[model samples]
Each structure stands twice: as structure tokens, then as C-alpha cells.
Target: MSNEPVGVLVIGAGASGAAFAWSIAGAGMSVLCLDQGPWMKQRDYPSNGLDWEERGLGEFATSPNVRGLPADYPVNEQDSDISPLMFNAVGGSTILWAAHFPRLTPKDFRMKSDDGVGADWPIDYQTLEPYFALNDRMMGVSGLSGDPAYPYHEPPLPPLPLGKSGNTLAAGFEKLGWHWWPSDSAILSREYEGREACINLGPCLTGCAQGAKASTDITYWPVAQRKGVKVRSGCRVREITVREDGMADGVLYYDEEGQLQEQKAEIVVLACNGIGTPRLLLNSKSQQHPDGLANSSGLVGKNLMFHPYAMITGIFEEPLHGRRGPVGCSFWSHEFYQTDRSRGFVRGYSFEAIRGLGPAQTALQGMVQGFIPWGEDHHRAFARLYDHTATLLGITEDLPEDTNTVTLDPELKDSHGIPAPKVTYRLSENSRKMLAHAVERATEVLTAAGAVETVAEPLMRGAGWHLMGTARMGRDPKASVVNERGQAHDVKNLFIVDGSVFVTAGGVNPTSTIQAFALYVADSIKKNIETLFDDA
Candidate 1:
């Protein structure tokens, strides 16, 4: 019902949206952010409750495919074995992500040049280096210096203690003569910017009640709000409405009460991740854009990618204190991160040293992996796993394929009566080969570390956390949805700053890169406001 036009209308308050909103709003723009999920207070997080695991199963389930919350739109993944996982909240998936922050290596930007496979990023790492530092300060990252794998950058805080599990894994990498370093994390090691330090409450994925982990709800949103950015929660955007001139005009969304409303804006920016962005565009079909808004290339929903994951566990004879730090990986190896034609995979993978699973998670995973049976032997099998396991997860780089796509479901609809996103993805032969090689290398490292037994799973379903490349960026308008600055090639007033604009999925946790690219786009928009507004 409102007819006021804001300076900028940003959809999705997740990592990319938060960063862009904060950057643009700080420059004194009248920015308004909209998110389908609620703004949960710190006390409302599952970590504050006694039944944390039970809460995870119901309200805070990591995967949208599993949680099926009313706020969450369903994802139809019947054709794909790897299900998409996400959290619908003010902070977006940051609410559920383990705070492990790793920057994409420089080589990742030049995948085509380095490996002769996959598309090269339109912009290189050097162009994004300053933004990476800017985002690091904004997120308050903690890590160690002197990493040979990087181009010399210092983290804000000293690395969080490796603890017993991290030290165990570090020793394994050292023994094998592989390059390893302490992981950079978004969780605070000491109080900074009025946020408290981490108390080592174990799992960072359940949401940090202590305000140590830097979710956008506690970090960028607060700062952006203080800078006069208006964030409206519980509003699900149905479609991006375009003007008669073929430019984005506004968005049609359902309010918390399920009433349709339109908020016009001078510029429309989409930070709705890969799946959400494509789905929204696909659903916005009109006479102007017969396919979808700004979808002239017909590539909006194609090239969906999820980093193929393989988890390997090692059983040690001696007890290792596992429940003392973040459950996301502590130490990581880039030993096999670069392309090696001898390995038979175009791109490479990273080895993340994850902590051993807790009792509940151990039992759950053990049952699924068939390591433990029900009834009589269950207790004994569980006892063996307790405090005696270490895990290494191999994150493989997934190349873009036109077949891996996000389409609109014909029959399935969300609680808001919008068609749900239909995903169809399959592991490429390159990915399968990469997983096989990474598992073998990881097993070797674990065995070298004096493990009595080792168990490895080639691939796990529902490990699709890094949703990327559905609306990729490139110089060729025909090949990409967006330009180098995240501006849609077809619509000058429309921009996208999220994983959806990734040209290539690198072999690392993508949040760091996602935030950095968002900052880059925001800065680009700020610098070119006159040109951007002139087109309108």
C-alpha cells in the first residue's frame, strides 16, 4: 500500500545483503532491506536452550529441505541427491554456518588459465584484495599470520586456540609434510566492537548465544541500522516488478500478515543467494521479460553449484578433547588446493580438519554411516566413538554445468502460494574422481598421525551449503547473468551481490569471498551512482 520510493531496495539480509546494505547505507543512501525470516534475538538462539539438539531437529535444522519452516520456501530436490541447506533469518545462512572463514586463493579467480577448465572470474583476487580486508575488519576475523598459502595479510585477532583436536590434526599435517595452517574464523577471540568473546561453547553451527560468532544479525545489521538503514523482517518477496522502460522498478512481497505490498526504489539489489535469486527471477515472468526479469541470456537458473563434500574420520587410541571449541574445521591444508593434471581433476580440493562429532551427532552420523547398529551393540559402538575420533572433510571445487539448475516447480508451492524452487544437480565425473583422490590423501594423513582405525564416506547428501553460480558474472553478456560489477547485463538499474554471481566455485568456504565481492559491488555502485542513476 505504501508508495514511497527509497534510494535502494535490497532483498535478503544475509551475508551479501548485509555487507552491501552496510556499505551503501554508510554512504548516506536511503536503504531499505527486506527479509522473509524474523529478526531473532541472541537469547532466542537454540544455544541458549537446554534442548539444543532437539531444537536443531525442528526449528533450526541446518537444511531448508529438512526444516520446512513456514518462513522457508521449500526446495524440490527429488532430481538431485545433494540437497540445498540454508537458514531463513535476518542473518540468513550465517545463523547456521560454522564461523570458519577462508578466503579464496588467487588462483581460484583464474581457473580457466590455471587449469583449462571452468570459467575464470571476471575480476581477479587483486581487484578484490582491499575489499577482502575491509570485510575482514567488518566481520572481526581471527587467525594466525605467516601462512605461506596467502599473499601476506594479518587477521584482526590472534588465532583461536587449536585445542586438543586441532593440535592433533596439525600434527598429522606436519608429519605428512603438507602445508597446513590455523583456520581463520569469524568468531571473536577477544571482546571487540562491544561484542563479547567466545566462551568455546563447542558447536558454532547452532548459533552463538554469547555474541562471539559474527553473524550479520550481530555484526553488519546493527552497524547498518545505526547508520539509518531500515530492515523489514518477515516479508517474502514474490517477484521483481519492472518498469515499462524494461528496468527494475520495485518488488511485490507478502507482509507478515500475508498481504501483498510493493516498495518502489531507485535501484534494486538482490542478495538472495544462488537458489533464492534464480527462483525469484524465474517466477517474475512478464511481457517485458518473456523468460524472466533481466533473464535475456536464459542462464539465470543454470550452472547451479554446490562444493562436493567427503568426510573422513579417524579413531585415536588416546582421548582428544573434542567438545571445547568450534565444531567447524580448526586447521586446514592447501597442500592439494591447486590444479594437478596428474590427479585427473581439472580443479583441486581443500582438506578441512573438523572436530570429532559430539554424542548426539556421533550417534546420528554413526547410524547413517552404518558404523553403529541399534539394540545391543549400539552402546558399545557409541562408547568407542566418544572422545576418540577426529574428522577431515574434503571440499572439492565444482565446475559450472548448464544441467545443474534451479527451476520453478509446476505443482509444489510454498506457504505463501508461490511456486517452490526445483533443483536438479548431479556430481560430475570430475567431482567423483576428486573426492576419491582427496579421501585417499586424507586417509594417508590420518594414518600417519597414529590413528588405530579410519572410516571415510565418499559423499554425503544434504551437504549443499555453498549455493553459488546460478546467476554468474562475466564479460560476455551471453554467458553470464551479471557484469563484472554485479550489474545485470539486461537491466542497468538491477544489481546482484551474492554467491549467485560467482563465476567459479572455489575449493574453500565461500562466506569470506561472498562478503568481499559484496563490498566490491557496493563500492562500485557508490563510485558510479551518477551513472547508475542517470540510466533511470
Candidate 2:
């Protein structure tokens, strides 16, 4: 063997990266994981009684005052227009995610066959079902199965409790003859796997202080670390260093102090999220591939997707106590997930009734409604809307189009003088139609549930959180960046394991699919490691 390290180097310590490292290390391969964020413990999260600003919750939990790559040092902007809300912490966005872990229906994979609109995934839902089950078990998801709209799901350890909103929505669904079921969430309901059950604290998006949510920091990362996987935080990988033969050697990154360092490995895996992965590939310029590393197909940053979300808020007459439970617990409507050409949309969407707001958030809502600037009216509004109000959020699927893309901004660069990823995206006609359908459905549900008032927010270009389909995987090398196995078509030892490899963006959240794809890629890497090293 050469003097260089004979292990795997994984980039981005988020869900996919952490899961990949854990799996690869569990397979007995030495693994080095790098994250551009800090290692945050559970104690760092906020408490219920603490002030929101003092608690350092929300955006402050992951982003700290630092100067380095985009991960270590966030792009600080006063205007929300210029800022992209993401975590720069070890667990990536999972640290602050709402922990809604719904699985994609079988129809999600074969969109072309079912919808005749977007492209189909190279692999079907059956091929990914086993991995999905594995992920649910590993993450300790809480849900009940037997929904007629989807294939039978594996039973959860303990079903999550349904709050008032859930019960009300369920009643409405039954009354209206619409399909509804309990949402699958990565939350503890009965204290399985040595973790405590949820206390109905409603702090999931701010980081679960009670440890009920299954972020990678609490799930796979700990197991990987215990199994001897080495994780180095504050390490931002800038480029994937390749040898003359076009095999990936390792990576070049800047350490915490902004010092440049390089590590050579037998294999290099890019687990960066949809945005970061394409940025790294597009920045790694070399003689062998001038456009970018693994850009021989020129499909590095095309087909960007985000699930268009529409939020419908309903103000009730009595307090519903929305601030107590998980953000996305209780009732869900997947009745429209299948493609209905009659609706004038190629794809479909799901409706989820979420819990109500906390004190501070309730106060903000009152302010938005032009309640008395402060004092009596504000207090009265807060008291009335605190428990009674409910929100039904829609996650609409977006079809992949070449025009939606992530490209380098020639004018903007991070602290390290590297170009930032400029997203130029627009909702497709299909997506617009889907959003309209979702709004109409949500309004009808709220009205049926006896909602006194309702307001609908339409889907904007970047409002959706489900990011995918950038460095897509397919059978054709000329049309896709990676093959079906997630191996870069232009490079042998390089793999892109994240939402960026998605050929299609399903209606559900992308975390479960991302983890399954990582597992699939890990299996391929394990089977071909010897040949890959020999080629290197």
C-alpha cells in the first residue's frame, strides 16, 4: 500500500454524511468525517421557560460567530431576502428540522409512469423499501400503519400521541370522506432505545432539548463515533483532489484556523447536501476536467428542486395548546399524493395539520394581524390564539426541469474567498398547479374543521424545504452526473451521496430517501473497494 492513508474520507457531517460514515465504518473500513460546523451537544438546545433570544434557539443554535468557509462561518445578512436559512452545525439541518419523517409513497418513485410528467427514479420504491425500514428502526420513528393510500408500512415501536388538532383534523377527514392517517415522525413516544419519550414541549424546530428527535447528532453520529469513526469538525472541504489517472485521491480543505490542508484516501465520498455538493464540485477545477471535477457531462448543478409548501393558519375560538407537542404530529392527508391529470397538475401533494404556536410566536402572529401594538389587545389575542389556533401545511412535489439550477455567483464569495452558490430557480407550471390544488384542499379542510378564519400562503420559488435533483443519477452519462449507483460517471473513486443524486423529488421530506441512498451507495463501495484502490 502507498504511504497515504488507506481509509475513506467523508465530507459534510450532516444526516447523509454521518449515516454514510457510520455504515462505512461499521463495515470495518477506516473512515474520516469532516464537518464545517461545531459539535453541539443536547445541552446546547433551549429550554421551555427561557427567552427565545437568550436561549440561542432557531438560527442561532447552529450558526455561531466565526470566520471561515460557509459551513464554519455563515453568510450574515440583515435582510432575509439575501439570507438562506440553514444550519452550519455538525448535524446539518437536522439539528433544527421539525422531525417529520414521513416516507415517500410507491407512486413517488415512478413519476413518469404514474404522472406522465417528471422523470422516474432509476430505482423503484421496492428497491428502497428495505433501507427505509432500516432507517426508521435506526432513527426510532413513531407511527401507525394501515393507511389505504400507501403501501403497508412497518409498525413503529410506539405510536405518537394525537393532540387536539390531530383529533379535529381526523374528524374532519372522516366527515369529508378524505383519506387521513397518523404522521410518521422521528420522535420518541414511549422511550425506546434508551431515550426519553416526548414531553409535548414543542421545541423540535429549535433543537430537541429533551432528546426525543432523532437528529444525526443523537442517532447515527453517536454510534459511528463509538464504533471508532473519526469526526473532525470545523473542516471545510473545498475540492476533491484527483490523481492524473482521474481517480479521486482525497480532498483539500481549510481547517478551523483557515490553514489549507490536504488528506489522501483510498476513496472520497461527497455527502454534502444538495447545495453544498454542487458548489464543491463546481469549484474543483483541474486540467483533466476543466469545467469542474466530475463535470464531463456538464450536469453538475442542473435540475434543482424544492417541494413547494403552503401554510394555512386557522384562528380558533378557544386555546388548543399548540405549543406543547411536536411541530408535525397528528393528522395527515395524502389523498392527493397521486398524479391527477384532471387537476391540471402532473404531480400531487400531501396536507399535514401541525400543532399551534408558543407564546412568543403567538405574540408575533397577533402583531401581524394588526392587533393593538402591545398591552391588552396583544395579551387577549395571545391568550385566545395560543391553544385554539392550528396550521395545516402542505408539501407539494416539484418536477425536475433543467432550467432550475444552482450556479456560482461571480460577484459573491464566502469569507474564504470561494464563490457562493447562487440559486436561480422558478416554480414550473406543474408545480404552480399543484400549489393551487393544495391551497384549495387545505382551505376546504380548515373550513370543514370549523375554522373561524383561514389564510393561504402560496408557494414561492424557494419556499420549499425539500431540496434535490441537482447532480442527478441516471443511466445515460451524457445526461446525468452520476450513474444509478451514485458513482460519478466521470470519476471512478468519487461518489455523491445526498439529495443531490436524486433523479426525482418526491412529495415527502427527503431525509429518509437520502439516508437510504447513502446506504445503497455504501454497499456498492464496500463491494468494489478493492478494484477501486487497484485502479487508483
Highest-scoring model, TM-score: 1
Query: Tens digit of lDDT per residue, candidate 2, span 286-338?
Result: 88889998888888888888787878877767656677789777767888887
Task: Give the clashing pairs for model 2.
Answer: 200-324, 319-387, 319-388, 320-387, 320-388, 321-387, 322-356
Clashing pairs in 1: none
In model 1, the worst 10-residue window by lDDT is: 527-536
- Score every model by TM-score: 0.98, 0.93
Could you tell me the lDDT of residue 426 within candidate 1? 93
- Candidate 2 overall Cα lDDT vs. reference? 0.77
Determine which window of 10 residues in candidate 2 has minimal summed lDDT. 75-84
lDDT of 2 at 81: 21
